[model samples]
Target: MQERLNIVPFVSVDHMMKLVLATGVERFLIELAAYIEEDFRRWECFDKTPRIASHSAEGVIELMPTSDGEAYGFKYVNGHPKNTRFGRQTVTAFGVLADVGNGYPILLTEMTILTALRTAAMSAVAAKYLAPKGARTMAMIGNGAQSEFQAIAFKAILGVDKLRLYDIDPSATARCQKNLAGMGFEITACSSSQEAVEGAEIVTTVTADKQYATILTDNMVGPGIHINAVGGDCPGKTELHRDILLRSDIFVEYPPQTRIEGEIQQLDPDHPVTELWKVITGQVPGRSGGRQITLFDSVGFAIEDFSALRYVRDRLKETGLYEELDLLADPDEPRDLFGMILRAAKPTPVAATVGAL
Candidate 1:
């Protein structure tokens, strides 16, 4: 039997990649979305809060933490848009899950790939509830590492097959197009956000610039569209114009956090926005009318990460893609930790050494 207290299962970047490939990205996303939805249904059971962030001129680093009464989880993530200039990823992360009863870590895993997956899955989940009925097209405003995953998730979850893509850098758009070429999407590369949003029922603005960017103006956002505003995920970072927010009914993961980090930050602190969990649990309406615009102001959240950690923990048993890490000290007696170290320092016995000689 495995000694659960002393060993932590570590899923490295390589193992994460293997697990993702083995699971098939689309299937994994669909499965993860199910888990997210399940957690959202029981939203009141979790301990929730805004991510704690450290800011810098170049980017921001954040720690997202959450817990159910039984288990605890946290993710350390960084967002440095300028890192792309040095050929590095703009966002990277890792996470840990621990037993709340014992305060022992149970799992450690690379969360960079997982974050991309979960973010896309979360967006898809929101879109499924809030998007226009029979919505088939989407405008992907920013083409970064996250763009392809968003495309795949929407395809798997919402049956969206037509994509209109626009990025300020043409190379980024080309990369997104090439990555999604064989994915059965009818993708059109556009020169501007306006061209991309045209004729699309769902408009997703995921730009990377850390400014108050107006990627979508009020006039450009017609009624009856669902806006997935993802990139405006931190204070001082937003994509939609304030006027657009005034015209749309916004749905958020956590209002306290979204008020600080999401596009809703541009609105009045007391402005009304529906909590998505309530919609998922049938406590409130999602898409009320054919002409009402619904906006999912997503800033990512801790419960989503908690759900992801739970999913990964469940997958580890089936895939065996993780390694055992000797992360905790286990002594013959729990209180004799100092004595255990002393005994190890005593070295091999002289009699045993002579017998071997």
Candidate 2:
């Protein structure tokens, strides 16, 4: 076995970008989805909980932790919807994976981009089971950094070929259109959320606001549409109206977490919502009929982050897109940590000669 204090693999932002580019974003999403699905199938083995969050007036900071008996993982993430005004990303994250045997981190990686990738992947996974049959078009209501990734993941996973884009900021929609040019998508930039969701099979609401703003009113939602609500992730944040939750068959990653953070927070605490893992594992039914509305109230869970971290860790060996970080102390003896620090304090021969002079 390798020494625990030798070095930990660190994947910085630049290295992560390189790895994603080399692997191809769509392919990476597909592969990452596979890992997530695999974990969900064996869901009973992992220790799960709602993410720990600290809310501020401007944003929220969250720590998501999980363990699967053998390995442990956690992610530190923050969300600030107003950050764009200062030319900063709305969400940024980093994650660590450690050995359960020794409690030492084995990998540390930037999760800002990885979070987007995994969120898209997780949405696609849910859509596969909950979306209408033969779904091809998706109305993307938010065209920020996560827009292209969501479009591509749906395309790669659910064969979605058409995209209708809209954003409160027209510039964001334009940027999304420019980024998705010639990506085999029949794209349209709509002027309003109503226009975007018109005649769409899947309506994805990902607007970033720290309030209970209704991006999609109940009147706007129709039958046979899968609502991928991604942005309403904090206590007071929500996208769809309360009536929409009543009419749809809601599916969530974890109810305890989603109840506090997801769109379903508007509903009763004990409202019936399907656990998504059960659907993936065939323990329950999804999309019972063409007219049934399915809502995936995604709040971003720890297990999804764990799956994404594991996927990146596995890929690092092949791509060599990581740096070795001296993140731990390597003492001569495990119990002599203080002695190791004291030994390093001894002067070198050059220092001793200069002192004598």
Candidate 3:
């Protein structure tokens, strides 16, 4: 049997929780934002695609995969709004980082909370390019698991102070308010989406339902507002009225993926939209005037997950916070895959030598 050496380290959810607490969520958001922008700047260096999804009556599950010519990664995440009723998180996610050179996994960990952080970070990155200068006071249309992260992201990255919150579920709004209370944000619980959106410079939507629900109509939106559409990340799930998309200058992470999942799903396939990476890379323009409306259709692309995975891996290395896992057998002969496991249990040497006819 061929023997090989591999390194795979894993960090549990508890370690991740400790990492966030030690580094601070704001710092994590800032670092993630920087990494995402850095990766987006080199758009052609990565292999990108839309995520694969499996739908069911309760909710939907997804697999996001991407590669940067050298390294590959993927995440498994589920969105079930009803799960919270049973004391389970509405979303449960796990991801793996792998070496594309040898097609072997290097690390795997839970990403339920990590996904929320990355989604918020991505939204903030788009807002940094598209939102007006000195933009603060955001209106959050849906207050669920994502609301607190969105609030903190905007607050830290964009200097937003005031947040007007609205959600169909009163408990969800209350939960968001309670989580964000100690963070020094000026939170206002609005009775409706329209009330929440009134006079706000940035409007963020992160509802969890798995259907087409109009959280923001065109008439409710005013001029010069930057919309961060977060929850409408799957096919047939949308949050904005079609008219709002028709009136705004739409921006997206990846056009090919966003076309099938973002708020622009309501627009014609031929409708014009700007890729946010182009703006970050100076290949395109962002907001040109204070009177212009900007929309960021964030569908949580695989490249963002790629960036997040790399960031987490690096952090674990820096802090020495991971455990080594024996996921794959390293057989010295790369071609002798079958003998590696068999010999591990029984220390018998293989009979056939490689290339011995």
Candidate 4:
């Protein structure tokens, strides 16, 4: 009998590029948002754990793993804020998808570009639930690699027409504006964080600096604004004032993980917050009042990545793209895994003793 080996598929950035090109970024975002929402609705069914982290003087490396009984997935991501100086991105990542039944991987992919896409989709999804209805103006603080994605997601999902941009680096702001020009977005470059945040319906902070940066103080934020805290995703890294979290009704993707990585890390351990899934599943109220402030503490959860991967997988199906690799061991004799190796060894000509011959 032949062994039915479920082999893993190797998906590269080129495959991901095909996926993105086939589905289009906007459609992919919508589909990814739906997948993430569905996953959140079934949150109790999955096995969850905190990511493993390795820290260094320059940056940090992280591995986030999760399983849904049938499938397992993990992402290897690094945060090196100083990498930009070396002409590299602040964050780079890759991930894998596996079958839990046999402990065999199904796919491996470069997650740098995918992470940006999923993060933006996740932010948009959170804002869709927490933000006020018909919110059109958004202030993007700390413009960087993620700024354009956030802007595009907001534009596609929430119909945001105006953007007030701010960044510590003037070049970053210029890049953001240049990237978004002629995209039908009303762009306003602001001199200060307060100016960028002033009169905005939604405030998104996706800074790249690895510091406890208070980009937005309480005075800068106004009532009925939805704060998408994107950049403050790692420990000791934050953008909003602690008072902002205390005052606003905070929502997170995963509380246990977020408590350590999100902007809420600055708050008390018992600081009241609602899981975003609860709102999606109708277990909790999303927006209680129009004037009440809301904060979506986005730490880039694994489930969102899972959803994005699934979306990319489907997109790849139509384009006939992606290279398939043999990552799983498939021996003709499943029980004799050692036998396959023994068979491949070159047979040495046995030299008989002259007397024996």
Candidate 5:
């Protein structure tokens, strides 16, 4: 065992892809959801706080952090929807999992892909409790980076494989369909959001625009339907109209944060909302009636990211999907860090003869 104090494991984008491929996408989602569920069960044990964010005219950058008494984890993520216009991903992230006892990071990994996976898994976990019994088809309103992962997670968890896809840009829908080809989905590319939700048991609105846009209106949603409102995860940005929010029983990860970032931002600050952890812990009911509309106001939370970090750390040993990194400083003397650094400096070699210029 490499017991170097400064050696932390790093999983780059390539290793993350290899790990996901080796684990299989659906299986990975299932396993990741299990980890999320486990953490939610013990939700009160975590030191929770809303993510720290910095906003600008163009986009927002955020730091999500949390600790479960033993392990500390945080993710640095940025969202700039306009990046897609310039051939860059709208969201990119990397995270670290550290030992709470000594504040030493044990793992660092790229979370751009992991965030997508964890967000999908969190949505699926919420839907499993709140969605109607035996729900099948889903209306995916936003065919962007998060659409396919959401579809696969629902498929792996709740057996939802039928997708009615739509996006303002038809090319994005085409790309989404093409990416998810042969994934055992009965796909229908619709021109309008209304057409997409015509027969959907679950309607997911995941548009990437960084503004208040009603991707789903009051009439677009129906009774007994579950709405996974994934976009609108920031201040001044939302996806659903106010009327739809009025008719739905909203479930959120953190109310203080969601009220400012999620679709419920349209509702009153004191509007009643149930915490997802309470529902997961059986302290509160999820879906009460057949005609009740359930809305998961998913503004990605730190606990979910922590769970994703934990899941990836466990998988590293089995798949060998991480590289060791010298990230710590271990001096011969506990208090001699500076001496260790100076001693390791390159010896002053014979100065190269300066060419007479």
Candidate 6:
């Protein structure tokens, strides 16, 4: 019989890069979105809760966890807008997938890249149900680390390739435009958010600032427009003005959490908002009319990450892009953790012979 070793498959940053490159980026997002949508279709069967967060002056650290009866997953992630000054990423993350039967982690991965990918995928999935049919133009309001990914996701999933990019820093916009060159996008670098949103069928706000800054004004949103609100994910951070939320039909991943961390926090606690899962499951309407505005108040959710991890696990055997990590204690005899440690402290027969020589 094969031994049950105390090891898990760990996908490091290097391995993640290889895996993503090995599988084309667009194809990965499309496939990952399918996993996310599938989970939402069965949303009733999983454990759901608001992400537990630790906030500070610098930024926020959060744990997003969820499980279907048979499998469990969680991600440890941080959002620090000031990290760029120190030559670091604004967000960094890692996640684990485990078996619910025994609670042993099956796969562990670096989610800094995965989070960006999943966040973009989640936005596209919401757009699938809520965005206007045949929407092709998107206003990318923030050109930070997540902007390019958002653009690629929309293109891959929704066929949105006309991008109007904007940022407080022109350099960020330049960087975003340069990165996406020849990616089949009709690109425009706009001077202001108002200019960026002009004639756009969909708008995505993905800034990384950790404050209550309104990136979108009421006048910027128009009829038949879909807003992918991605940045206001913490208690005091927001992107769109409260007036905008009042006019739009809002959808979210989890309401208990969105009320505290999403754009809906600007509205009354009891204000009505539909869960995106419900729309995917066809329990409610998505776009009631071509003249009505829709908002996907997306704060990253555990279930989406759970789906992303599951997709990565499914691809491991075919890709061979992960490293095995000995991260658990599996004793030959049950309840023999101490004995296992003692056994490790002793030298092997070959080591003893080498010492004798």
RMSD of 2: 4.0
RMSD of 5: 5.2
Stretches of candidate 2 off by over 4 Å are 1-4, 347-357
- Determine which window of 10 residues in candidate 4 has minimal summed lDDT: 348-357
- Name the regions of candidate 1 deviating beyond 4 angstroms: 347-357
User: Candidate 1 vs candidate 4: which has greater TM-score?
Assistant: 1
* Model 6 per-residue lDDT tens digits across residues 1-357: 123457789999999999999998999999999999999999999999999999888988999999999999999999888999999988999999999998999999999999999999999999988999999999999999999999999999999989999999999999999999989999999999999999899999999888899999998889999999999998888999999999999999999999999998899999999999999999999998999899999998999999999999999989989988868766656597787667668956643343123
Tens digits of lDDT, candidate 5, 134-185: 9989999999889999999999999998999999999989999999999999
lDDT of 4 by residue, 260-290 (tens): 9999999889889899999989999998898
Q: lDDT per residue, candidate 1, 1-357, as tens digits? A: 255566899999999999999999999999999999999999999999889999998899999999988999999999998998899988999999999999999999999999999999999999999999889999999998889999999999999999999999999999999988888999999999999999999999888988899999888999899999999999999999999999899999999999999998888899999999999999999999989999999999999998999999999988999999878876556798896677667744642232223
Per-model C-alpha RMSD: 3.5, 4.0, 4.1, 5.9, 5.2, 3.1
Select the stronger candidate by TM-score from 1 and 3.
1
Model 5 weakest 10-residue run by lDDT: 348-357
* Predicted structure 5: lDDT: 0.92
TM-score of each: 0.96, 0.95, 0.92, 0.92, 0.96, 0.96
* Residue 210 accuracy (lDDT) in model 5: 81
In TM-score terms, candidate 2 sits at 0.95
lDDT score for residue 317 of model 1: 87
User: What residue pairs are clashing in model 3?
Assistant: 2-331, 2-332, 2-333, 3-331, 3-332, 4-330
CA lDDT scores, all candidates in order: 0.92, 0.92, 0.86, 0.84, 0.92, 0.92
Q: Which residue runs of candidate 5 sit more than 4 Å off their true CA positions?
A: 346-357
Q: Give the TM-score of candidate 5.
A: 0.96
